[model samples]
Target: MQSSFSPLVAISPIDGRYQKQVNELSGYFSEFGLIRYRVRVEIEYFILLAEKGIFKMPAKIKPAQLRAIYEEMSEADAQQIKETEKTTNHDVKAVEYFIKDQLHQLGGDEVAEWVHFGLTSQDVNNTAIPLLWKEAVEESFMPYLLNLIATVKEMARTWKKIPMLAKTHGQPASPTTLGKEIMVFVERLQNQIDLFGYVPYAAKFGGATGNFNAHQVTFPKHDWVAFGNEFVNERLGLQRMQFTTQIEHYDNLAAHFDTLKRINTILIDFCRDIWTYVSMEYFKQKTKKGEVGSSAMPHKVNPIDFENAEGNLGVANALYEHLSAKLPISRLQRDLTDSTVLRNIGVPMAHSFIALKSIEKGLGKLLLNETKINADLENNWAVVAEAIQTILRRVKFPQPYEALKDLTRGQEGITQKSLHKFIDGLDVADKIKNELKAISPQNYTGVEFDY
Candidate 1:
């Protein structure tokens, strides 16, 4: 420990530069947090044993004394466990010892023997980690995602009717409402987020090889499998895998990371699109009084927030990819690879948290350049060719597509007059010709949606 902690010396930005912004994650992901959760699982398991009648409580011991083991955990309690870990060289064993010591202190030495009875370290690690992850997602990630979605939704509503030039293959095509374009991303995000809801936050609770071999061996009459399912599902609020090795299969956890990867991919796409819009003058950022975009280029009001978002999201997705690929595969019963990898799970999450903040900040700074958006639409009158060609099709006009293709395609700066002149030559009835003549790039966006 330093005399004064500082971000300057921290290795990862998650614990350093961005610490303040992501401090809320500490209660679920930090070292002390891990120890705290481990203690919770141990205490709960001890209590569960009694409730299930697998362990009879000592006469002098009260249930409240057991509950206080975790409810009253503190920095000193976690530090004591850390001190015990040095001697045991096993994290879960250290927690077991700490809980046993606590039970002794409560004058329940008779009941202390049941602290971690018939369980391996994975029993604690798998349950504690998933429980921690569950809370982190529910408490931290989902809110950020929902808030971002809502903010974008509000932007869509505010700009619903504002027409902008659409691009296909980097060339002007038909026009689209800015809101509709924004909604494209909103729909993509919501679709994935909806699917994310179905991917279970699963855990493995079987003793050593996912079969409750030790549990069944010790208590031949007890339905250990049923007990595990009920405890993991009802008590811990997580899905219990029916079969496993020494570790969880991690298939569901991988799916969760994959879902997060999809989300980050969508967000990266958004950041880049927004950045491009800023470069194209379709957006102006609200600049602060003394903030600098460039060291030398003084006039620039850069889209740094979006850029920040893109970078962090890319980093997050990279880590998430690794997690998805590596966590699900292990040798035979189990290996140590998943052990070290699981510990760093919070790193990717931290990156994602950072990315969401950047995106929110970027979105807040956006000021739509209506004049530029309209000018883009006005200048690309050739975009109306789609509407004209479609209307021409309705009138049974031959060669309408070729006619417009010849008149506008590859012709730089085709104006409204040029389109109207082409409409005048059409063999359609007067009413239909007039309809075609009235269309312009600014008014050519197809059927508006309520969103």
Candidate 2:
């Protein structure tokens, strides 16, 4: 049955099922956003031309008038550009026409012909996309990622001394503090985010085939290359790729995607570890009123938030991998492949945002079960064999590790009493024996938990 809703719908889930979680990103990713960016590039280019006196624009265009034109670019103006695009069937040409129309209203029609002078569609698109990406990262992605890191840091500080039994290959091995485990992720994410910052948001402004052919033919005396560099790097605040095909190489963008993927992988690792901790009863979830963890299972309070984060991180990493791999490998000088792919740059980012929110939610729900942590550590007294053996080594005891291994290895349910009894029978001095008794699993978490 057809509902009352419109038949038109987005093919991607970013605009469909998960739309609400990512709707705020549309202002930087939608068709309207694309149009707005294009207009901005055209407007900036025109302003730069005037500032450089490349074209003898009308003297009536005062500084205030230029500011007004730039500031007055509203949603309505973006819509007008879209309307123009529909008629022209060429996105960049439509922008040129739109700017020319606006210039007519501003009584600057005498210089309208030079609006898109000596450039191709790639010039506008490359600059606009980088601008959008830069703004989105600074405004949306970075804040959330930094917040996540901060949340992890807080958890690290809070759980700094909470000793828990450590497992290796699913077997009790040693003891570690919960805070140190959380700090591992914090350190990993910080490193990857640092790498992400190093990746430049690069753009290409050379004409059709990177030669600036038309630009040189029109004014051979002018250094169009130098002007392109200044316009892109200085005015637009993007790294200008001096040499490229019709489209940018996208190597830097690929590096950005790879960096994001690494961070997501780290978060995925964190979610899995937290989920396992919850399952092991080391962490209990705060129950929400009216929230059903399961439909039929009354006693089930699932780790839904962490599960959600893991799923979204997986989705985001998949997209990031594809973007990083595909964006840098165009067919030749240019192809339409990157154009369509570029439009969905925000999809992976939206998933990343969604995952961040989920992780934050999961972190909020976590209630550390100190009793469980202590009980687990207390029960795993066999873990202290490492400490006892190491201390014995310090005192030059004969075959200290072998002695501890014989006493603890394959011995099920080795309690504190059993370990202490074995320590008392040792031929070590009273001081060494006392030290061994003090090395319980609860206090044996070496420097792993020290913040």
Candidate 3:
């Protein structure tokens, strides 16, 4: 909490160069933020114990005042908790002490000892961390993702009718509508996003080693398992993992990270394709009045946004992949490895947040080059060989693929005249030959597709 760093001095770019792009995540993942959420869980759990008839409310206490604990917490309060942690050398216990101190101030020192009774540090941590993650994803991250998806959908609709030459294995293959090609990413992304909704945002609520040992032993007959399920599910708004070690198994959390990795990978693919199109002159970037594209060149408008997005996305995916692989594997009852790693969960999310904004910015700056798209369609006349050969196959023409292969394969210049001349020389019926001649690279795009 000491003030020794600014953006200029920060080591990680997420907290420095791109801080503004990713600051929204600080409310959920920063140390102050984590402490705030931890206190919230502690307060809520104390209230739950009261509601369960485990204790009588202290006569001097006001329930309304108690519920306002998290809302009323300030930077001073978070700083105090950090100071307390320095002495305790334990974070959650420090939070517990902070709550007890607050209770004493509120004239309820009689019940102050109940603050974190019958709970392990993990109960507070796992619940609080998942709650923070759930809120961050739902409120902050999804909006950016939806904007990118919506931008893609809008581009698909706008470019749907624009014909362009399609490439396969770096060669002109068939003709496709520009919109259809863009929609391929939209559909693939949507499928993965849909799957993301079902990966349970789960938490481990049983005490140390995940068996509710303290609660069961203290109450003797308190239905602690049912209490844990209801408290985690209804009160905390997170799924309670039914079993675990001293920590949550983190399987669900790993699932969440893997899903994010997949989504980032898809966006990486998108960035590369758009970069290629920009390089090919099929798209141009709008420029700011005074922005420089190069240090020495005067006439270059680089696709830096897409490049930034690709780079940031790669970094995000690497973290996500590591989190998915490492978080779920633990040493027997549990190890301290996960504790440090868990604290860094926000690193990947922040990088991804920056990348999404970059992608959105890149999409907004695009100026579709229709002339170049049309020119490619016009120049690549041999791309229509697929349509002609397929029609010949439909009409039972002998060795239609072979025939079209002979005419178009590796040919330097196959124009409308050359294809029509070949059609004229074919032994097929005049009507069939005429149909083949009508198929042009400009008009041979497949059936209309939209999503």
Name the runs in model 2 displaced over 4 angstroms: 1-11, 63-71, 448-451
Candidate 2 lDDT over 254-340, as tens digits, reads: 999899999899999999999999999999989989889889998888998888888988998998898888889988798899988
* Worst lDDT 10-window in candidate 1: 1-10
For model 3 the TM-score comes to 0.97
**Cα-based TM-score, every candidate:** 0.97, 0.95, 0.97
**After aligning candidate 3 to the native by TM-score, how far in Å is the CA of 173 from where it should be?**
1.3
Provide the overall lDDT of each model, using Cα atoms, as 2-decimal numbers.
Answer: 0.88, 0.86, 0.89
- What alpha-carbon RMSD in Å does predicted model 2 have with respect to the real structure? 2.8
lDDT of 3 by residue, 79-99 (tens): 899999999999999999999
Candidate 1 lDDT by residue in tens digits, 190-222: 999899899888998988788887788889999
lDDT ranking of the models:
3, 1, 2
* Model 3, C-alpha of 435: deviation from truth (Å): 1.3
Q: Give the higher-lDDT candidate: 1 or 3.
A: 3
